[model samples]
Target chain A: MNLAKTALITLCLMGTTGLVHATDPNLARNLAATCANCHGTNGKSLGGIESLAGEPKQKLLQKLADYRSGEKPASVMHQIARGYTDEQLDLITTYFAAQK
Target chain B: MQNRRDFLKTAGIAAAGSSVFGIAGCAGMGKGSGGHVVVVGGGYGGATVAKYLRMWSEGQIRVTLIERNTAFVSCPVSNLVIGGLKTMADITMSYDNLKSRWGVTVITDEVRALDTAKRTLTTTNNGTITYDHVVLSPGIDFMTDSVGGLSGNEALVPHAWKAGPQTVILRTQLESMKDGGIFAIHIPKAPYRCPPGPYERACLVANYLRQAKPKSKVLVLDANGEIQSKKALFTKAFESYKGLIEYRPNNELRSVDAKTRTAELDFDKVKADVLNVIPPMRAGDIAARSGLPLINDRWVDVDWITYEAKGVPGVHVIGDALFPAPTMPKSGHMANQQGKVVAAAIINLLAGEAPNASPVVMNTCYSFVDGKNAMHVASVHQYDAIKKQPMPVAAAGGVSPAANEIEGKFAHAWAQNIWADMLA
Candidate 1:
């Protein structure tokens, strides 16, 4: 990878305060609803796709980071992981993590 | 197949605190709480907004959804129904969950008119409903005038675009067609509901005819210059379904003769045993009727942040009625996303907080090429403050590398999951 790309990835890995923070609950819902297509609605999965409700923030963040990087292999997740900035991903992770 | 051993390890949703995005926090709050929001239509976008508003507000805001039909027949997987892979009952959903689970007052009635200024609406069966805010998710209406001479052809040519009886009409026509007959589908230009849908319909029908009646063929009359969405994947399907699917782009329809089962293209005339034409579409008729500030007298113009109609306070338009943001296709997935955004905005507004300026939106639309094979197109659009549009983030999302049976399974999973989200 180029120096800039490496630096950017490094910044994400280091967990710099979310590149962009979403405070509004609606923002959280809008982002969270997309995952329901595969994960089950409201983060509760009966089977097939994994349920994302009530996950720990750090664990969810790492999984998302893994998907963003090559460590985690997924067709849709990898592409989805790259869509948001470090901050947006962090917000989404935190949102799901807080669900119970 | 992206299989996993752990379900809990993978995913779920968090409902917590500490605002992250800069546009968080409730300001000017306490105005909308205890207020009523009347949402019209109960499709993906409408149903979601009604459900989310109640969820986020925690019973602080009262939501009433008014839809003409008691049950929602999804258009997303309706093609599968026509192809015989699925049935109408499988795709149909009722508002029972919305009423019981979310406490939303689901009213079954057609809206007669909307007085946006007064925040009131009249329904066919039900009496007038006054609200503090109104959300219009009227969905799509065909530009019938776009194709002339289709009046008498109504019974002969079926669009089958909207899910319900028309779907059965087209399916019956296909099933009854002679062994060597031709099935033709006319695709309207872009900005129509579901960009890749027509192409997907062609793929499913072609696959069905391939097995059901090998001697049969599918003819496509597309108005656009080329395949609009998932170009590579659909192009591949077209090649694979060879001898079954024949595509002719730039075949804009000048007129159609249902009795003769023929359409006059720009230059040549084409005929089919059974014809299904998807008419060009615009915002639902109510949007235009209420004078909700349309861009070209068709689509409703709104602030993407809040989904509020321009120049019309307390009115919001979501779903296929709103003009799409840059590169945003009018798919159910996107409509579902928009519903939440608008619901959140309404909730925040009632709380007296400014709506979030920067919001990220995403879409994942799965198109089944056949009963077993499916393809997908995903897009992630971030709110661009300068351009004031939702622009697709580069390299974040894209089409599946190719069509596969695995995604096909996931497509079914997606349909079930989304249905559960909206209805259950």
Candidate 2:
């Protein structure tokens, strides 16, 4: 009868049917795995490359936005940042930020 | 670090209002969804998949990797070895880490046959092994017959494409050549392994000859009309070699005289002291023999979302073996990315969950034009729901402004990190 109850019912139906609601829970984790090849597994880089794990999510997102906007001067990240949607970038940065 | 318990708790909370709405736990949830996966050819793709399967599965999924070579030698930087900048040891890595650290069963054996119906594979020495899912990452096998007299005479004219003995042999051939002698390299057509490899080999070889044998000349005989990758940068790099390096386009190899080290082209006969002929390539031998559907009778066609060979259940193929979506170069970086995708996909499938619908894979390929300077070409590909394949993002990735020392350092760091990413 109420909006909160209706929303809860919709979420319950989606979860029970194995449909993703809002976002796939594993999407952020999977997206962040892509950066592991260069930045290190879980973003803890080994060599000269910057480590992304545990960095503030907003900081990471801002840097990525700068790279996408051509405001940040990078050898490779500038070109790489333009590939993902804003939402995907948000999820990836959140996932990496959560990594300790 | 969201574990299965956390995921379930969130699901439970969402379903609390109704007893009728019950959440079914994924069998693949938590550690050890418990399936045996046998991966063939432990190169970039196979090794990464094998390691990631065991890792992401928390040692629950059994992973057995069968590779022909005992050690892992990277083809990415093998050009430097041919150019005499780096040695064979510098590019070679061991598979011990994959076995000891990751609990992977690493076998140095060649895969002979794939019994898709039974979900088993027969190896050269390891015998037949059954798997819930089988991953084939057998990299490109050269079409040696494409070049005349190139099949058995590899000792005379080494392709050095696979980055092992042939690499050393090619380097040795260059070392053996006298001053003012010609060292000719023949590149096969595009869509071969490592698009920028041939040009990098040319630059490195020229770099070697410039200092070691200044009088000697380097000749590149290419099948394609233009440079395959990093054209402008490679073109400019070639200019640095000026009279030392000569690049001929559209000159496909008709044949070769192995005895005299002479190349018989359509228009010209090139005589060289050392002839390094890189033949056109196809998916490895086992892949071709496995009866999977192939594109152009060369690359396997697979569903990009699952990396599963079309119509072939329980069998997945990745790396250069798959028919690339538009503009997807078959490089190690792309292969590693594909490995992770398949790993996550298999994990989800084993757990009865859906694969990631919005999968993304990107590539960063760096080529050394000289000993200390390199340039890179990068692109990112996201799954297109309409096309049902990963398409490159427009206005996203591009080549370097110019080759520089900083990029060269990054290239080295890329190698170190990527090697560790796959093996360590």
Candidate 3:
């Protein structure tokens, strides 16, 4: 009886772990859509806008956070950034920084 | 196969944790996966940084981009849109090409805040993210207050400088004006984006009037005694386009009564049926609020060699936001080149490798004087590490084609190629 209970607990933990992992890619993709507007389809911005396709993830995240926290203060951007949560920011940073 | 699955699983967990709590993980150690990078702006400088970082790093870097708009409407060619030769859609771009072809992540969101100390970024809807490096390419902000009566009244008098609805508004006003009515175009002092943009706009508007409303004329009000960039070519074109357009030099616009459509200049007041007021500019508001070093209204003072901020460690500035050596006109081409150089430096810094002691940069500025005639200027530059600035490369390139046929053809080709290089 004791052995069966332990096995059941272990299985539940593994299943939860797999579930968490499965959701990351989708989360990242969803987050990336928000950035496609000015940056090109691939992270390149047309004309004078800069490209963010293959930058380092951490650097990208820091800058975004800075802008949101009033460390950076673009008039239009500040108004635009007020809608996100902490998790979406990470998903976006990791996804773009990981591009080839 | 199981091992591969397990590795992906681990990487996913790590990425999630890093994004949520600002943690660095081992995902970067995987085969050809350097790490994740996210960029906030998708402008010329940002796009170049993203593209080259991916190219030079191979599959080691994964790039994600976040921006607020759905399409990129270029200010560079937006004037053409106003001239009626091009449409706003013609200057717009989607991320489909960049994503499918380049393997980049594109997020269409507004970045709200950045925690540089924590290396984390947050968006209005996307949540939090941590990055190893971040590049900002948000463009200039107009100083509407520079001219009194125009303060806080974007709706009353459109600046149309950003190439979106403002461009459309300005164009519509011109289209609907009376035949023999006066259209006034104001040009500000130096250090504005696209030094030749306002002048190009004047020529295009003049061309439009020549065929549609021959009696209509354009009055150019200049803040400086002489116009900057491709002056000789523009002067010649103006002479050819005369009668349709009139030029006024050393005429600074002081105020505007938008209700009456009247503009007060330093020397005189001009009443017009239409007004296109291009205001003075500064680095976007975010740069100033962030406490980044500024030369007057600029952002991110840096050593030209490394593109590293002078006082701030690990921060860099490029594009119209930075103070480049005098004579370096702020153009998209210069911004792209600067992006590449800065990306290289960042990659080197990350790999624990030494950056090139000296870097070379190239710049080109092309102006479409009319549908057929175009002029350009190209120069190569070398960085002086000791002086921490750039000096021109001797005789590598010069102004536009010496021959007429070459100039005309090159202008067309240059426009196509530059657009391709920037977008495609």
Q: Classify candidate 1 by CAPRI docking class.
A: incorrect
* lDDT tens digits by residue: candidate 1, B1-424: 1112121111111101314311211211212356789999999899988988887777778999999887999999999999999999988988998999999999888888889888889888898999888999999998877787786566689999888988999999999999999999999888889999999999999888988898999999999999999998999999999899999999999889888889888988988899998888899988898889998778999988888899898999998898888889898888888887788777656544456677677889999998888878888888898898789989888889889888888788888777777778
The best-first sequence of candidates by DockQ reads 2, 1, 3
Per-candidate local distance difference test: 0.80, 0.86, 0.67
Candidate 1 off by > 4 Å: A1-30, B1-32
For model 1 the interface RMSD, in Å, equals 10.8
| Per-residue lDDT value at B177 in model 3 | 89
Q: Tens-digit lDDT track for model 3 on B1-424? A: 1233354444445545454321123222122335566766777777666765676566467777777777777777677778788898887777665577667777888777766677677788889977776766767888888798998666657778887889899889889989998889898887788888888888888888887888999999989789776677778878888788899999899999998889999889999988889898887665676566788755557678556556664555678777667466677777776776776666554543334444556565657776666666666565655666877655344555321444445444444444554446
Clash statistics: count for each candidate: 23, 2, 99
Chain A fold similarity by TM-score, each prediction: 0.71, 0.79, 0.69
Winner on lDDT between 1 and 2 is 2
- Model 1, residue A71: distance off in Å is 3.0
Rank ordering of all candidates by lDDT, starting from the highest = 2, 1, 3
Error of 2 at B110 (Å): 1.5
After superposition, the stretches of candidate 2 with alpha carbons farther than 4 Å from their true spots are: A1-22, B1-32
